[model samples]
Target: MKFLRDILDKVKPNFEKDGKLHFLHSTFDAIETFMFVPNHTTKRGAHIRDGIDLKRTMFIVIIALVPCLLFGMWNVGALHYAAQNIDSTLLENMLYGAMKVVPIIVVSYLTGLGIEFAFCQVNGHPVNEGFLVSGMLIPLIVPADIPLWMVIVATAFAVIIGKEVFGGTGMNILNPALTARVFLYIAYPVEMAGEIWVSGIKEGLVDAASGATALGVLGGKDLEAASNYSVNVMDAFMGFIPGSIGETSVLMCLIGAAILIVTGIGSWRIMLATVIGALGMGLILNAVGGNPYYDLPAYQHLLIGGFAFGAVFMATDPVSAAHTTTGKWIYGILIGVLTVLIRVFNPAYPEGIMFAILFMNVMAPLVDNYVVKANIKRRLNRVKA
Candidate 1:
């Protein structure tokens, strides 16, 4: 480590302010800061210096996502082989899935980071670490068979418009990963939707079949008719159902949620509120029971689609989520309710978590403002009393 540090120190002068390679300062600093914590400290103003920097924070999130990524890879391969009735070992499945998934991840990081670094270099600002998490997230949420060119374009759009245009990182209103996902989903619906969720099916080993997802099956018709296409609740819970790479597995999402909660990086209030909101809405729909989809159990909604993944990973983004405690509750509940409403009412789009989260991200500020105003009013009343 010391040898590596010494090498960085030696080459650092070339990337410094008046040096020959000054234009590449952001690139050099990005690598150096990643390898070691910056030693520079606040000298004057009151500041709470801590070991947990933005890089560490983002790295923790990536660590939390590991279980989902690994499981998604295995699931992709397993689904491919299962469709063909080709009995293969777990290792083979994982290896095959990795071949498909890894390239997307690499392209996402390379493209997103390239844009981010370029923006930083051109603007003479320190490189921000927000892309570290967004880069990994974009691949996870999209269909496994999505084109690489789409991923590149979506990533560039996310970094430039969704983030950089809004002043980057902490200033952005929308989650960059979600922004990229929504762009692809809307602009290239053909590629982002339909039977493309699972990879390896194009090998001609299996007969043609409807690649509709579990939620799609449920949303397509009433309960009795849909049961023919419905997956077992246990399968959905364990993630044997077809969907996005990281979103199908409720078990993995819970595991990731636990890591985020234990690390104190994610908001428990928002999570609890989201579940409560969903359950409440589910119960209401069940009682009214106009549609067979509404008759589906409330708890099952939590397991299917991207509800769990969005609640854990996407909705809880510190930058985009509600800041006030009360606002978090309102924001989460709205997301839950909206997700259910959109999924049930809009049959065209079976999954609604992405739209729900992004919509809430837009409304988070309004929620926070109301919460803050109430807090101020309460404080004033107490003083008068």
Candidate 2:
């Protein structure tokens, strides 16, 4: 450590103010700070000092996401092999999955960080740590088989339009990862949707296996007909179904959720309210009972599609989500309700959490405003008494 610090100290002067390489200050600072916490401290003004900085906070999120990434890789390989009716060793499965999944992750990080670095250089501002989490998240939410070119384009679009255009990270109105996803989904629906989910399916191995997800199956036909394609609830719960890379596994997402909550990095209030809202909406739909999709079990809704992943991860984004405690509940519940409503009512999009979260991200400030107003009103009433 001391050796590395000495090397950094030697080079650091060149990137400091008024030095020949001063333009690269943000880049140097980003690398140096990532390697070790900054020794510099505040000399003035009130500031809360903590061991955890933005980089460490984002690193914690990355730690939580590791379980999902590993499980997603395994699921991708397992689904691909299952589709072809080919038995594969677990090692083979993971290797094959990694071949498909790792590139997307790499491209996401490289493209996103490249743009972020460019922005920091141009603006002469310190590099934000937000992309550390966003980079991992973009690949996780997309199909493993999505084109590498698309990943590059989407990542660039996310960093430039979604975040940088709005003054970067904390100022962005939408989740940058979701923004990239929504861009791909809308601009290239054919590639983002349909049977493209399962990797190795393009090899044309088996006719018996279908790439239609559980949510797709339910939305596509009546309950009896869908039963032929429906993934068992247990399989969905266990993440054996074909869907988005990381979203198929409710179990993995829950494990990630537990880690985030335990570390105090995630919002439990938002998570709890989101689940209740989804269940509540599902129950309401079940009671209406006109269509087989509506009659589908409420609890099952939480297991399938992107509901679990989005509720645990996307909706709880600290920057885009509601800031006030009460507003978090409203924001999360509305996301859940809207997700179910969109899935059930609009059969065109089988997965709704992406749209739901993006929509709620836009509404989050409005929700917070109302919550704040209410709190002020209550305080005023108490003073009057």
Candidate 3:
């Protein structure tokens, strides 16, 4: 017992001393002190690390995302049931939905985490839990019926090229989730394109039914309805319409956003800025009497497509997004503007979240550069005065 106590004493720090217990501090301390390298100088004079680490941070995101995920599962089953014209209890429908979505989640996590673990082993560093959120994110952004092998390839590519090659975790330039989506988009154009993907049941197996997405229907419809009222926009907003599994529900995404902001895991500036930018562009189109012109109003933009989901989750990626407050505003606004632009102007892709996020990823560094320079310039001016 004394021997065991001595080992514990050596491995574990006195948390009472610091008044906090950082998630892995004791374990990390043990690994360093006994296993790897002792005398690891605690740099930054940082005392009493918080209980939350990046892993916990990422895990919180996953937890916040649960509502959307559960809703998506139920929705998937609902769509299938509706298509098949079969009587199903809500629970049964949800099970059917889970049958489809769960595998995608499993495959994504397994493949992405496999890569992350290998990299951690090779690099001799502790594993980052960022992929926990990212793995779920990849499937959520993709169509429900995406091929499993494709998921594997995309996950590997995103983890290796999108992240590890640039150096893991905080070093990557592109959002790893977006990276996986982009690779899948380019590599399997037929799969990722909105038209090629199908949500409801197949023709023979179920009752025959066919319906275009609200966006597609609206795009083709006379501009008259857009001006008159919201129309089927409510269905899209509530997530009854067919689209990606998780992204269909703006309300659920907002719930996740609320948690993220409250927890300090995500930036509210980016979230608000994105909504404003999207609304701004949407209102402008309304005023111009353009194709998307409608009395439907600007606020509708927030409920449509993947705008809410992307702004809340994908756009706020700490690694690929702006670190500075000013830079975050700029980055977020551009994403909103670009998302609205793509959704309105491009007839090909109904949702613009993927494009908007990737476009902003490229510009994040420039945004930061200018923000930092402005701060420096102000400091110099102050010194001169």
> Evaluated with lDDT, which candidate comes out highest?
2
Give the per-residue lDDT digits (tens) of candidate 1, residues 224-318: 76755545789888998788888889999899999999989989888888888888888889988876687788888888899999999999999
Clashes of 2: 0
Identify the runs in model 2 with alpha carbons over 4 angstroms from their true place.
206-209, 221-224, 227-231
TM-score of each: 0.96, 0.96, 0.84
Cα lDDT of candidate 1 equals 0.88
Stretches off by above 4 angstroms in model 3 are 1-48, 194-211, 219-231, 293-296
Return the number of clashes found in candidate 1.
0
What is candidate 1's TM-score against the reference?
Answer: 0.96
Q: Kindly list the per-residue Cα lDDT of model 2 for residues 1-385, writing each as its tens digit.
A: 9999999999999998899999999999989988997787899999998887787789889998999999999989988888887999899889988999999999999999999999999999998798999999999999887879999999999899999999997999999999999999989988887677788656665342478777777777456776455458899898988888988889999999999999999999999999999999999999888877887789988998999999998999999999999999899899889999999999888888899999999999999999999999999999999
lDDT of 3 by residue, 157-208 (tens): 9999999999988998999988998898788876675453345533355442
In order, the Cα lDDT scores of the candidates are: 0.88, 0.89, 0.78
